[model samples]
Target chain A: DAGITQSPRHKVTETGTPVTLRCHQTENHRYMYWYRQDPGHGLRLIHYSYGVKDTDKGEVSDGYSVSRSKTEDFLLTLESATSSQTSVYFCAISEPGQGPPEQYFGPGTRLTVT
Target chain B: SQKIEQNSEALNIQEGKTATLTCNYTNYSPAYLQWYRQDPGRGPVFLLLIRENEKEKRKERLKVTFDTTLKQSLFHITASQPADSATYLCALDLSRDDKIIFGKGTRLHILP
Candidate 1:
């Protein structure tokens, strides 16, 4: 749990529709990340927020956007949902300089776009 | 391109036996390596981490060995139980990257 919760545990959306997944953390960790996991391909980072209003792109940051308006919330928005974007999305939180920098992840949100 | 590779096929081990898994990487110098366990439909849980300077790290029945020279890591579970059946992912962090890269994972089945 790690005091982390993601809204819409499961979602089914049509192609070209807008979708937003929310990640809320009570631990107030400075670092939060968004990752998508699919078959064959492992977990791939889509976007990460280092601090309030500070974000960076990861290896696979295309067709996706993120926002961290508050310390407890990180939002992932798909402007136009596509079938290729359907997968399990996980939100992880970690504190910098915390020994090994291990991340605590939320349960995950399973999104399917048809 | 940087890459990390783990056992592509599922590994089956008998109960009470030691199960060893391998992780190999190329084209990258990682500051540390980590192992994570993920059950179906659940997020990954961190198992252990080994630094490049450390040869081996142990926690209870779990042990991780890091060989920088070989650019490999070996994860072992002694006295394995059926409950340990899951996918184990090997991830690495580079000194220059803010995010960790992960291998697809090796699914281990502890047959009872």
Candidate 2:
């Protein structure tokens, strides 16, 4: 288990409501990513932050937004929850300066939209 | 467009038998590929990573073969046990301007 933690391990929300997921890391990795896992679609990256105040959209970035104000924290927000957005979300961290380290994942946050 | 394909069906094998999983891709030249193991209700854990120049990599009872020419990768587990049951995922550095992509995944069940 890495020092990464995702808040609200499980949540049930309604459509058209905004929701936020938080990822906190103690390893202080330089790279952090937010991904969603679905039945037919594998793990799809929604957003990633290379460093504080730097972020980029991933393949499935629509309906999702991210913010990273510090090296140890990254947040993902769903502007308006949709039934299609119901999926297990994972947070990952990687240390590029630490000898090609592999990404470590959190336990995961299961989001269900009604 | 870059796309990754994996077996949507689950693979069932008896204990002491071998299991193989497949991952295929198209329209993308990846620099590196990785395999991961995930259990239900949990996130994935890294298993192995193979480079584009490498053909195969192995660890313990697990073996991975990557064929760039075929644009596919095969993962094998020998003499698998019930504990080896889990979903396997393959990811590539599809990287449009440097990005990564993941395949849906193939579930494995080791029956005792």
Candidate 3:
């Protein structure tokens, strides 16, 4: 398994509340990504970071924000939680220039917004 | 917009038989396609990757075939076992954007 870990492995928050999830990696990979998985929708990219302080939005970046101040940590924050946002969040890491760039994912964080 | 489609239904295969899964896409052909496996509660783990130019690639009991003309990819697991039961996902690179899109995944059950 990759040396990646997500904090607050499980979280339950009420609607309109602030929620934040953290992803930490020891691999020092240059690329880090946040993804959300739901039934029937599969996995959707939320945000990604290529290097320190460099980030970009993904296909489903609405209502979500991410910050990568350091190479080892990436954070995802939901300003106000919604029931539709309830899903399993996964953090993945990849090292570019290392061939095909296969991503290694963490255990994932299951978030429930009611 | 690019779309990837995989059978949403679960597939049942007997142990020691071969299991094949299909992934079809619409839009431009990707330079690289990847496969991953996920258990019920865990994140996906990378399995195999095949490039558009390559017709087939193999690793251990797994094989991946890419057909650019058909805009599809096939994943096969031979000599299947009960332990192989899980959801398999297929992902493809979106041109040279450095980002890949994933399919909904197909669940496979290896009945013993």
Best by lDDT: 3
Model 2 ranges with Cα > 4 A deviation: B96-98
Q: Determine which window of 10 residues in candidate 2 chain B has minimal summed lDDT.
A: B93-102
Instruction: Go through the candidates in order and give each one's C-alpha lDDT.
Output: 0.93, 0.89, 0.94
TM-score for each of the candidates? 0.98, 0.95, 0.98
Candidate 3 docking DockQ: 0.87
lDDT tens digits by residue: candidate 2, A1-114:
589999889999999999999999999888999999988778999999999999998889999999999999999999999999999999998875465446789999999999
Better of 2 and 3 by TM-score: 3
DockQ of each candidate, alpha-carbon based: 0.80, 0.69, 0.87
Query: On residues B1-112, what C-alpha lDDT tens digit does candidate 1 reach at each position?
Result: 8899996558999999999999999998898899999999999999998988999999999999999989999999999999999999999985455589889999999999
Q: Which regions of candidate 1 fall more than 4 Å away from where they truly are?
A: none
lDDT minimum window of 10 residues, candidate 3 chain A = A94-103
Better-scoring candidate (DockQ), 2 or 3: 3
i-RMSD values for every candidate model: 0.9, 1.7, 0.6
| Superior candidate under lDDT, 2 versus 3 | 3
lDDT of 3 by residue, A1-114 (tens): 599999999999999999999999999999999999999899999999999999999999999999999999999999999999999999999996888889999999999999
Pairs in clash, predicted candidate 2:
B95-B99
Error of 1 at A54 (Å): 0.6
Residue-wise lDDT of candidate 1 within A1-114, one digit each (tens)? 799999989999999999999999999899999999999998998999999999999888999999999999999999999999999999999886866788888999999999
Worst ten in a row by lDDT for model 3 chain B: B92-101
Task: Give the distance in Å from residue A113's predicted Cα in candidate 3 to where it truly belongs.
Answer: 0.8
